[model samples]
Target: MMHQPMKHNRPPMMKRIADASEPYLYSAPALILIVAVMLVPLVVGISYAFRDIQLLNPFSGGFVGLDHFRALGQDQAFYGALRNTLWWTGASVFLQFTFGLILALLLDKPFYGRGLVQALVFLPWAVPSFLAGLNWAWLFNPVIGPLPHWFYALGLMDEPHNILSDPHLAMWGPIAANVWWGIPFFAITLLAALQAIPRDLYEAASIDGAGPVQRFWSITLPFLAPTIAITVLLRTVWISNFADLIVVMTNGGPADRTQIVASYIFTQAFKRLDFGYASAIALVLLALLLVYSMLIVLLRQTMLNKG
Candidate 1:
């Protein structure tokens, strides 16, 4: 009995061990690499908030705890940046989701060249953000801009000059550009959600004499609610930190009216050479993004639990 105990188990033992954890081991390298790359820069940037650094001494700076945060509190630019960021996040996400939902619902029905039309609508989002900004810049040009030309040609405006320079529309110009840039993403996501919805629900509703309006209000929208809410949260997070369009289009210009948190932090740190203060501002932005994301996650989880 004792001699038979070992039982030549090495092959089966090796197979069992491999089967149990080889997948996790295979994934370990990528997980570590991602964590190091992402977390290191984030930690370094956050640490700078406690220091009093400037471009003149980028390599070394003194610790000045909370000073930068204090400075940012009194900075009018901070408040302006915050205001514009809220406007960007709220207005762009709202309009983008609205139009996207409409486009998705329409496209959900069978039609000719539907694929082509959807692709065409999505084309604006396919272009690089910087290029989109440049195109918008030209479109808003006062003298020879296409939009002003069309507008003035149609007798819509008094001038054919730069519309972005107009105080009334300058900030809005970026929002519209951002919205256009953002719409396709929402459409694609919502369309995928719409397509996944059970067709029998619609037929049942129709058989019950539910009109198009009633069906949509009752079935279509409720099914889409979770997806829409998540997308809005994500879009808000994205626009809050999106600096490229604002940078290339307006440079947060025309007197800093278009300045958002990201661009402002960039200006304070690199442009103004106030590293510490910029870090402080960046931390605030990070905190804001954290709050937004947490709320989205918690709400989504709650909804899922309720369901």
Candidate 2:
């Protein structure tokens, strides 16, 4: 064969391998940190669900298998917590989404002092959860706050009494606080999605003699369906797990009327020193959330297919 031109020297195979792996090497620390911080704790927590892990017990490391689950099945307090969780999550997500949609719609229109209005409305979301709970608790108090007085004046209540003391209404105290703080989150997210919709679609719909309601039903609703679905799902999960307000405001008091599963878990873990039982309850909650999320996703897929 004719003398071939000498091939240019290339990097050694080991060097090439090292070069290809350099990016991964750079990211290795963060990857290790995530595994150490998140994955390790998650695995440990799941393991704890199956073991006797009382915090104060010296000899509580034995694997008990499904014992905690069996006890949980017979626990009436857990059942009550489950029901309260449903009520709390349902009311909070509904009211937040409703008022948030309204706020987003209102803010979508150009107006004077729009920025100021938006900032004021979103202020509650910026407040710390503990502070928000305290603020709302105070507001519900008749001693220094005006809400009870307002309710009394409106004849909703016979006297200016704190609703947090009433078992029937204690859940509503945290729910109201949750709704106020969470509304801004939904408003911000939905407003962003609203702004992303093509203005031309609305213009075209208007040209076709579509009124506001018709335009909303025909164009706006469909565009917002995906965002609304995702937001509602996320908010449902978050509100279900949110125990800060309940803990700070009521501590699941009024005879445990305000106790949701999350606060119940807290009660089990810290108050009762039953870490294993708390982990079991958390595992159950996680399973329920997974199932609920799956159902929602399937429903969304089916609706999209039909549409």
Candidate 3:
């Protein structure tokens, strides 16, 4: 009597290929939709950046070289728009991350009414941007506005403060509005990350006689570093293009001190009816955004490597 040899059993490579192909069998439609809807529009915008587009008719425009970008080099308004855009990006992102982190840290602690406070704090994010902007726009109304009334009551103003017209305050006002509208989103997102942290780590730190600050520096921040980096990246992108809030609130008035790149581009294209020039502005903005996005990816990778 002899034991029979076991037969080797394995699917052929061709069968494996057929199995993998099954998933793509249903993905073709989605692929088509993505290409047609997203890729086509992006390609068209990129193409226009190289053309002499007109407001009257985009198709009738002729091809132009890099004159648009070259023109931007000599334009003062473009420079102003760039400066304001930088200010907006820097201030809004910094404030959003700072406040959001504070809220997240506070909410991370155990307290009564924690759930209610979190839900209430996140309410600003639920409302639409335009609506929130409009609400702030009204609150700053010079004569009848609550802001002016409160300032007067507190002896902070001899007269009503013209928020929209004051060069010093105009930009900050919009920044405040945007931060208010944006904070809750960051809070909720960061809170989720905080909650995902392991309790055992904290317990171990406590057992080692670590103080609140020591435990936070060693355990908390390191764990939340990735989340903070991601939040900064996302907030940067959104805050950079925050035009609806600005436009609805101030329309970039008072000698255009508060005009951001997006609103400037809008005014140039739609208000001035100079589509070619506006396209150039838009192309420049696109370039900056691309650079920022790349920087974000690099920073994220660096942070990830560190942790």
Candidate 4:
């Protein structure tokens, strides 16, 4: 040290830079692919929202600024779609979470035919969404479906009729199918969370004279809270943008009673050939989703802090 550390050699600047960037160099391919596949299309779609881009028009790709957004602001059908979106997302998420938690709780304990029951619970998730929609549509059809007959026998319906064609009840059809298909997601995730919980906590709670409900509220729920918040947020976003089942089952039919924002975008883009308008709608939906996501994240953080 007294002799200037024996004139120890250091790598040149270029060599040091290369060594520092080794990790990024290895990840460069994935980054490039992501930019090309996701970022590029995202930028292009955002540009479309500010232009006149009709697929049928030969010279339609012209900048229109906020014209599409202004028109969207005045579209009554778009407003109706917003309302339906709330109902659809709310009912579907609520029912799926409720039934899924019950199923998960039941499956957490040993029982006869538990394996078969679990398989059946997860079967709907494996089925294609389009196929599931079609199957549910058939099940709601008065001509061939037994549901209407069963409802009639239960004194719940005036007659065996196709509820999907009835505007008053048409929304329930897709909601029911969505709940059935989505329950498996919540069930699987919740069951895993349930299993991860330590047996000692349950034993300790029982020793302290905690009842089933008390134990669940005191121990199980606190452990599952984080998982629940994340799963609910993900499901909410996915379901809000999901139009496949609605398009396949109802096509926003019965006077567009089932039209949601996602399906509305599809109708504009494909049926009307109005790419600009569709992009504008999509941009708005994206903004809304971002806001919702921020709220969920903030709430989760607050809960974590309190805990």
Q: Judging by lDDT against the true structure, name the best candidate.
A: 2
lDDT (tens digit, per residue) of candidate 3 on 1-307: 0244536465668867887898898898999999999889877877776778776874657888887778888989888988999998899888888898899999999999998998899898888889988888888887666897787789877887867778877887788888898888788888889889999999998998999999989988888888887778777877787788888888887778899998998887778777777878887888888898898899789867886
Model 2: clashing residue pairs? none
Candidate 3 residue 152 Cα shift, in angstroms, is: 3.1
Candidate lDDT scores, in order, read 0.85, 0.95, 0.83, 0.94
lDDT of 1 by residue, 104-186 (tens): 98889999999899889999989999988888887788655678888889997887867677755678778878888888999
What's the lDDT for residue 11 in model 1? 47
Model 4: which ten-residue window has the lowest total lDDT?
A: 1-10
Looking at candidate 4, what is the lDDT of residue 134? 97
User: Please, what is the TM-score per model?
Assistant: 0.87, 0.88, 0.88, 0.90
TM-score of 2: 0.88
Where does the lowest 10-residue lDDT sum fall in candidate 1? 1-10
Give Cα distance to truth, residue 60, candidate 3, Å.
Answer: 3.6
What's the ranking of the predictions by lDDT, best on top?
Answer: 2, 4, 1, 3
Runs off by more than 4 Å, candidate 4: 1-33
Deviation (Å) of 117 in candidate 2: 0.7
**Which is the better candidate, 3 or 4, if ranked by TM-score?**
4
What digit string (tens of lDDT, one per residue) describes model 4 on residues 90-164? Answer: 999999999999989989999999999899879999999999999999999888888999999999999899889
Write one digit per residue (lDDT tens) for candidate 2, span 1-307: 1254536566568867887999999999999999999999989999999999998899998999999999999999999999999999999999999999999999999999999999999999999998999999999999999999999999999999999999999999999999989999999999999999999999998998999999999888899999999999988998899999999999998998999999999989999999999999999999999999999999999999999
**Per-candidate count of clashing residue pairs (backbone under 3 Å):** 3, 0, 0, 0
- Best model number under TM-score: 4
Candidate 3 stretches greater than 4 Å from native: 1-10, 18-34
User: Cα deviation of 184 in candidate 2 (Å)?
Assistant: 0.4
Q: Of the pair 1 and 4, which is ahead by TM-score?
A: 4
